[model samples]
Target: MSTHVPFNALRPGVDAADVRAAIDRVIASGWFVLGPEVEAFEAEFAAASQVPYAVGVGTGTDAITLILRALDIGPGDEVITPPLSAAYSALAVMMAGARPVFADIDPARLTLDPHATEAAITSRTKAILPVHLYGQAADMRAFEGIAARHNLALIEDAAQAQLATFDGRAVGSIGIAGATSFYPTKNLGALGDGGAVITRDAQLAARIKRLRNGGQTSRYHHQEAGANSRLDELQAAILRARLPYLADWTKRRRAIAGRYRSASVPPSLSVPREFDAGHVYHLFPVLTSCREAFQAHCLVQGVETLIHYPVPIPRQPALAATNPAMCPVGDRVCAEIVSLPMYPALSDDQVSTVMGAFSSFVPPTR
Candidate 1:
């Protein structure tokens, strides 16, 4: 059997010596939690993001939840977001004591549709949260307009859009607050789990910092209750190693997507239409009515494929009583989406083999 192409190809882009040096430096310092590595990484990440502030946190989920808590968004507040995103997006809202209102996604982009977002708003709505799904920017322009009109905060879920842009500005910099994940597979991934919040507002930055460190003003001096969600020194150092290559990796992802588009795609399958949307192509999702059968076909061809999301949040049993609003587009897309291998480390031959599998696929007969 041929080796299966992986969805993510991690190469440890930094030299082994460099990684060892960083580890040695951190160990020698003996100050791990909320230490210099984390501080320096935050500053570097902020500079790379073109934002004035960056607060490192334990995970992407905590990043979003912390931003919500710092913004004082809780209790009866309702946050409007697309149901097509990771469950963590909705969970963050719930974690902050807010209700997550479901909204439809743009069928073409598979991201939060700004018009649908506005339509889903109620008097209880306090913010508009948009996820930059699949490494392509959401319609931030429209979302910004709607948020301004409604006097709601605009929080961007940039977990997959580390170096992605929207209308000439970095996605994270445009929103009042934004969150990102540095999971091992992200374009600029860390060696382990990590996340951050970016903002231009100084006050919000300070609040997020304090919140991440147990709400302490100084050693055991609790100003207010907060969670222990600080990003650790080891992971921060690893991410710092990867930050410089973000652009190159994103370029590789885009190149792969371009080849996939130009390949012989069967009429039964659909590729995303974001060639000009500054898409980083974190996952190259193809849509087919027979997703399961198509996956089996890929497996038989010695290629591995995965689903970006197999279920829509509105349909989640835990959310049954939130009386989740219907998102027909998101629901339909969820059933049909399949993610092909996507990552910067894929070689040209690997990409060709994956495309060849798609070109030769036959639809399952009903």
Candidate 2:
């Protein structure tokens, strides 16, 4: 009998006891928001991210927007970002009252092309926001060089990449600041929506802390107009409980991806090449000319599949007014990419089932 493989599982497994204890601790403290739990988690996560500070926020989207706002990047400022990531990446740029310029991605890397990003820069370009798609770090070295040359702020959209590294340096530490999500599906996810901004800049971290909590400098003394986007104590405590297992979870995700990479698939399907061995494999995506048919085939084989992004950010109806430049590589990638089941909870037998589904597929000849 073939085993059914899920796209991802979120229920408590090995960390159930720890998660329960964390919830109980938070409840017993009688404090819910911006309390000891959030403070402790911020310190722990900052250390984990190899950064000096971390600020907890309500969501990943807020994390990115708060970082941009804290940098004083808004209104006429332009932020160049890849067109291939989750729409939230671009949405965050807009949320900061800045315009997001769409840049084509590297066909192989599926990340913002450095050349494209450089070409997109204008006098108004204030920052280059790069998403580390699918737990793989973007070419941060190149981005760093470009930012230095152009005097642009480099903010990493690391919502999909936690505990990911590029060239021995942690992802969140390389940029001016990095924003990550803990939306119950991340590597170090919480029980509910949560996020944080990781940065080595003390001033920037302090600014974000104020911005996330209604721009309060002190108790009831509003310094500026800030949004209410604080990460509550329960979620923080829950994330703290799960943080220790991230390394092992990342290893398991990589191991499963290795199996998928080595497995034989139909000639029509292509597994994305790993640009760096440090990838945490957030989502194991495969490209096929016939995505619908391939997905149907996988479903028939009892394996679930999803599209990380079905449409390029520039092409979305919400962004049409941005008058974004054409991103041919990103456009093609959106149509072809499909995410297979990838999570630490997947059993070896289930991993085999996913591979078996791929092996048995026979794409229709065009």
* Local lDDT at 271 for model 2: 89
Q: Which candidate number would show the highest lDDT if scored against the true structure?
A: 2
* Candidate 1 residue-pair clash tally: 0
Model 2 lDDT tens row, 1-366? 689898889998999999999999988989999999999999999999999999999999999999999999999999999999989999999999999999899999999999999999999999999999999999999999999999999999999999899988899899899999999988889989999999999999999999999999999999989999999999999999999999999999999999998899788899899999889899999999899999999998899999989999999999988888879999999999999999999999999999999977898767
lDDT, model 2: 0.94
Segments of candidate 2 deviating more than 4 angstroms = none
The lDDT for every candidate, in the order shown, is 0.87, 0.94
Residue 36, candidate 1: Cα error in Å is 0.9
Candidate 1, position 323, lDDT: 83
lDDT score for residue 286 of model 2 = 94
The digit string of per-residue lDDT tens for model 1 on 1-366 reads: 545687666767444566667777888888889888998999999999999899999889899999999999999999998889889998899889899999999999889988889888899999999999988999888888999999999999999888788976897888899999887777777778889999999999999999988899999999989889988998888777667777787888889988988998788888878834577888889999988889988888778999979889988887787788989999899999999998877888888889988888898778
Q: Root-mean-square deviation of each candidate, in angstroms?
A: 1.4, 0.8
